[model samples]
Target: MSFDRACRVNVGLREPNVAFEKEDWAVGVDRGRLLVIAEHVAPGVPAIAAAVRSAPDDKSAMTELAWGLRGAGLAAYIDWAEDPEDVQEALNSLRSRPGAMSWDWWDDEDCEDCDEAEVIERFLGLAGDHSRRYGAILFEIEQGGDGYLVGFMEEGSVGMLVDNRSLRVVATGWQNRA
Candidate 1:
């Protein structure tokens, strides 16, 4: 089957019908898919499109865009206490699924016997480090035809794709699948 993956974020806008160039935002993103997602999350807002245009620079654009979305009630920031548990659970669950593979060598360490608590602790530590070093972290879960993909995109990273500043693919057992 053909690969299909989607990343969705809720976006709120003051002016739903504000006209903006969708193509100019998140350049690497699929416009058609974004349009559909925009329709579903906040009809007529085109939040991503607007934010990209409004941001000051390309390096900080995603961070600015995310903040703008959060301010408008479109996106959410992870609460380290509770959210990391859920994120850990998702990662552990993905490990059991077929075709699971670690995108980074560090993430491939032996953890077959690790319990929920241990997993969560590790995840929290990682999240903490990411936040301290990268300013903020944006969690993303992508559902694909083959499987699910998870990521922690750091604000310090350049481009839409993850780079040195981004968190390791530990939280996503099937990383880079998108």
Candidate 2:
């Protein structure tokens, strides 16, 4: 099975004239869906025009924009710019979890009879389920070949990362660490 490992920046832009420099990275901006994965930049890197346009001058504007993005079902990771304190608190709570980076089933011995594909599917499903529960934004990280690291960002910061392996998901760490 093949997986598309490209990490896309999904944005909901108010402006229609915005364009990107790297044509290769430009996925396409379709207003019809109101959810466009237009730019395929490296993970954690925001699209230039989207970033600039989303960024407002004042705190009130920033908060308003952040809400607008969220309301439009856009996962822009704009909470950091909107409210850093709340985001930090959420991160702290996530990191404090005893099982944040460790799981009992995350070992070969624990799932010796388990199929690799099934394990991957379960991990992905869990990630999605948690994302919805926490109202988080999902990010994908390419880990070479068929390997991928999925991150769930809630309240602007990363709350969890899951991988195909029963091991090394947490060991990989967050953001650039992957």
Candidate 3:
């Protein structure tokens, strides 16, 4: 919908309906980094909507959103949905449906996309491997603009970009206020 009114949730609250392990949150955070990069590099592009809607359901979308925030280096404040069960109910009918569902409307445009389960699985596998190796998650959200910035942060780090391969910081902070 309206990016201005786009809501955000953290990973420490109630877990979404879909099964989201710590690994899922790690990956979600990583994805968030990429969304942040897109916002900076492609001002009008709706990467967040695209990515979130691509999930199988609201729980999946929420998990994916958390990853997106983490990817953007804003991990500290991304709280899990307060009432994940409600979100689950909102998406129950659509969980195993066979069509793209509308997640939001952006400027009169409905944001709809089929959930890419395979792609998500691949990313999770990658993240899980990294998590096992370094005792933390290492992920890169690239916009391929001024520079390809790869953000490395502990799986549980707040919002600090521990390592940046390319561009410097722009806006860095936790989205949720605890």
Q: Rate the local accuracy (lDDT) of all candidates.
A: 0.35, 0.31, 0.32
TM-score per model over all chains: 0.30, 0.26, 0.22
Model 3 misplacement above 4 A: 1-45, 77-178
Q: Could you tell which candidate, 2 or 3, scores higher by lDDT?
A: 3
- Least well predicted 10-residue stretch by lDDT in candidate 3: 165-174
The global Cα lDDT (0 to 1) of model 1 is: 0.35
Best by TM-score: 1
Cα RMSD for candidates in order: 15.2, 14.3, 19.0
Q: Which stretches of candidate 1 lie over 4 Å from their true place?
A: 1-43, 46-48, 79-172, 176-178
* Candidate 3 steric clashes: 18
Per-residue alpha-carbon lDDT of model 3 for 62-115, expressed as tens digits? 555545644543332211222223322322232121123232321211113413
Which prediction has the highest lDDT against the true structure? 1
lDDT of residue 15 for candidate 2: 29
lDDT of 1 by residue, 1-178 (tens): 1111211121121221223343333333333333333233333456665655555654245444445444545444433344344554443343111223332333525445756445444554454344334343333422112211233333343123222112122323213233
Q: List the residue pairs that clash in candidate 2.
A: none
Which model, 1 or 2, shows the larger TM-score? 1
What number of clashing residue pairs does each candidate have, in the order they appear? Answer: 3, 0, 18
